[model samples]
Target: MDKMQRMEQLVEQLNQYNYHYYTLDQPLVSDKEYDLLYDELTALEAETGITLPDSPTGRVGGELLQGFKPHRHLAPLWSLDKAQNEEQLINWNNRVLRLIADYNSKNPDTPLPDPTYVVELKFDGLTLNLTYTDGKLVQASTRGNGVIGEGILAQVKTIKSVPLTIPFTAGTIEVQGEGIMNLSVLAKYNETAAEPLKNARNAAAGALRNLNPRTTAERKLNAYFYNVGYSDGIRFSSHQEMVAFLKENRFKVNPHVTYHDSFQEVIDVLHTIVDKRSSLDYLIDGAVIKITDMRTREVLGYTDKFPRWAVAFKFEAEETTTVLESVTWNVGRTGKITPLARVEPVELAGVTVQNCTLNNVGDIERKNLKFALGTRVFIRRSNDVIPEILGKVTEEQDGGEIVYPVNCPACGFPLEQRGAHLFCNNRLDCKPQIVSRITHFASRDAMDIETFSEKTAEQLHDELNVREPAELYTLTFEQLIKLERFGEKKANNLLKAIEESKGRDLASFLYALGIPNTGKSTTKVLADHFRDLDKIMNATVEELTELPDIGGIVAESIVSFFADPFMQAGIHKMLSLGVEAKPPQQAAPVTDSFFSGKTVVLTGTLHQLGRDEATARLEALGAKVTGSVSKKTDLVIAGEKAGSKLAKAQELGIPVIEDEDELIKLLNGQNE
Candidate 1:
């Protein structure tokens, strides 16, 4: 067949596979067959020189949006004043007392009201706004820049914990919540995950902001809506009453909350949370204490950005004794050498944490976290956020203090101190740096060359006499099968993943290129501006840094990638394999702000405007149409309920729009 026909067939097959994998959770073909087809299609696309819109190549979407258009917050989401340490927390206690004294002065005859503080676990997850009307859930948004949040109302409903339709009958209420995933699911996800996740908080935060809602759902995420963002026609005089109302409305409110008559009681609860922090399913970084009485809260009101009624009391990180088996170092993309402690497996939080970050040699000195072989050290994983060594030796553990390494642990090169960081200038040749770089190249956000997993990568390097990402394509199906643990099926699947990765849109490839600070978002902007991979490869530092998000480091990385004859050589090999990359066609600058306040939902197959076109248009305007309808949605544009979002939108009272023309007119600054 001609390259065009070949390309066309591959698109049809790959699109179907993507729908099955991404949309249906079922893949039809075996790993090897899919890879061959994917590889063929990528070759055809490169040979024919045409970019497809629905191509899986376009993941992460195009472009880091030129500085987000600011949307006026319905109710300004104020920042909370932080108590970084115990001293600040005590000052907060003193301030709460003064406020109560001032309140008593006005009603001298009445006994001084025993003011109460409600304490709740401060979850280490993404904060969101959920809007409800007449007890139906409508909209959900991220606290993007505090003033305007990304309207992810569609993604929000996919989360089963977030009620699409409220159980209680209330006019209008804004529910505040923390979107989090438990550690059990996190571990399970990491088992099948593209890579081992850093921590639960990063995983949870990444899940909420993900482009695909299906990903959000599969993670088994849940949330606890604690604060009343705003509720109309609801008469809740106290914080306790509001929380009770939330519970009555079938909302998942934090059950740990208790009303305290004094700061001492609040402190007691804080201590209790710190003690119990290691056992909770969800990570609690701190305790959020708020005034219980609404009238008292109003009296305290707010500062320029924070409410005076509430404060977050972050506890000192919980530390426990663990015997350090050894210390290892990892070289990062930024060249910072990070020290890790291999500890005796201990169940500190909900799971057994094995490795703890020592940060750097300076950190070792500062925390006295020095550890020699077999040294007993105080290990702390703060709220299951990140593990750290509290201290190493002396009377504390009767362990020997470890001497910090003065040379690069990997290459044994003399390390130079730059500020707080220690660096190994060996760059890409270093083993950790090479593995990390190659791994990054095959990442989901990057070139997405899935076949090069850690096992396959290790096998290829240590066993198959192969090294680096470029060597991946040269891997024969038989070679993959020959590796230990590699059955015919697993080998075929890995090959398919590699084939599918070829001919990705330039955005993904750039991200995969492992440029410093230049990942998914940065890749899109560069792809559009450069319009070709060769131009980007040849770009000067001055030329690269000109893009919005691409700063000095990123630009330097780009310049370095091309300069590294090694990286350039890899790109050439990839191109020779028909793993071509190209820029997307730039759409016209939109003038209509129709999307300004509208919440739109697109369904079924659109003709005039493809899914990508429709989404981009709506986003350019001021409209905040989400993927699903909740209490906050104004309308739904249904072509056909291709996805689950359509059914949920209908179950709610969202006004459904029919086609692109209707959406266009509505967005063209027209009411009709």
Candidate 2:
């Protein structure tokens, strides 16, 4: 067969397989066989240079777009009003009933009866609006504001569960759904990803907004149609009927939707979902309760931003009250001192939490957090990670106001306040600070020294008198064998890991050094700009500040750190110890770029790029990026969200660019 004919055959076969696997819950072919077919299709498409829009190979990805185009939605996507507790939910139900009663009174001939509710899980993901015409998918967009959205048709086409076409041949139909990455999918991605995704919601949102459709396809995103936003040639009497129609038309609808006659039943469904939340393969922050009767919804109408017929019942945060025992100060890698609260052991989200962070002295003062020994305090486990102290629950005070330490907890050096944080000036002498720095150097995200732990660092510091990172290379395996829990095999492995870390890239080495205000992204920027550690060491503050996202304070911090005699000696010692920091592979610079040599600041949340990604993109286009707005800033890109930097740009009269498309146009010298 010809390449075109083979491609058509492959597309047909693959689409059938996907439909069976994702929609039918059955598979006719093994995973290995499917992969082989997919590979064959990919090769054939490449050979022929012909790709069909509905082809299963589209799930692999497509070319990157310069920017997303604005799409005016056919119908308004209203945000639902939220209820945090049972009382609030009941109040909302009462309002719905009252509105329906008023409507019935007006139309005496056709009196409305009691209203029922349809409760569905509120999936924690990005809202997507899909438009279908003549049973064929035409467009997909995100919920940007309410009336207009960013077009994401290419990314949406890559999702296996989202039907490209349906059996129904109805005229223009718009369906609303959520674009989500399953928790299992996110976990698998995070296993090999350099930067782990925080949660399923963020993973899904990030994938959909990426400029590359291939990234979204690689994420294996899913969508569940819930509501019919607009229909030209179709009609439904109730929400339940609409959901049924969606399912019958081969669209993926949520399975947890239920029709409830009473408010108590809706509450029961919420409880059930909450109980099953840990076991589900997706994340749900709340349950949506909407009037089931279509007539009731029309009568109730909508408020400014939310529909009066629907309310979102948010699940209560996992929190409990515990007794505050005492507070302790801990020193970190950068010699920054943090206050920690030693709370009475309490079980939160199935884990025993004994300690929680109090942030700093400013946080304590802002929260009016006073802790007497044995004082009851509220603690919450947010996002199932760290347990944070909410506030003091009991009024009874047994101890005096908690005091901020004037000296470092480990080295007894005088503490210096830098903004909201307290820092220990003794960078070389503090034991805790040294241990933390060493531990961070060996962390997986930094140098990736396998088997290195905080306890190991502490033991090495206390026993072997290891004062600096270079000293670790001089330690013998025999010496490690002398430490507690260190056997012959373990000591050998640790030594091997230390030896391996010496060959890490310059970015990792820079981050391992624990330079002040230098995170992974900043280290990468520095490495990409300077290429070598020696150049970075000799760079002036002006040169450093000229890089993207590097502000005056961060540049000053970097210069101050590199100029320190102790730091210079330590770096030389490491280099002498066979630590080979490789320079980043170079790329040709972009010439005649409009953004070249311009200082730009991005404020609020950009739909297409995260803060780090935006900084990198702007830097790639030859723009100098900074975090804050200033009179010196040549341009400010303000996004959907509101932030202080946006306000400052207006106050300073700095020219502000709205949305990514406008920025792209400006960069292409197409701005009018």
The candidate that wins on lDDT is 2
Residue-level lDDT of model 2, residues 325-430, one tens digit each, is 8889988888888888998898776688899877777666544465455677777664444676756664445555788899888888989998768999897778
How much RMSD separates candidate 1 from the native structure? 23.2
In model 1, the Cα lDDT at residue 611 comes to 64
Please provide TM-scores, in order, for all candidate models, with all chains considered together.
0.44, 0.50
Clash count, one per candidate: 19, 2
lDDT by candidate, in order shown: 0.68, 0.81
- How far is 632's C-alpha from truth in model 2 (Å)? 64
Residue-level lDDT tens digits of model 1 in 302-395 = 8888898889887654556778887777777555788878889887755687888877776665554443457776666644356876555443
Error of 1 at 331 (Å): 5.4
The runs of at least 3 residues in candidate 2 whose Cα sits more than 4 Å from the true structure, single-residue gaps closed, are: 1-6, 318-672
lDDT of 2 at 340: 89
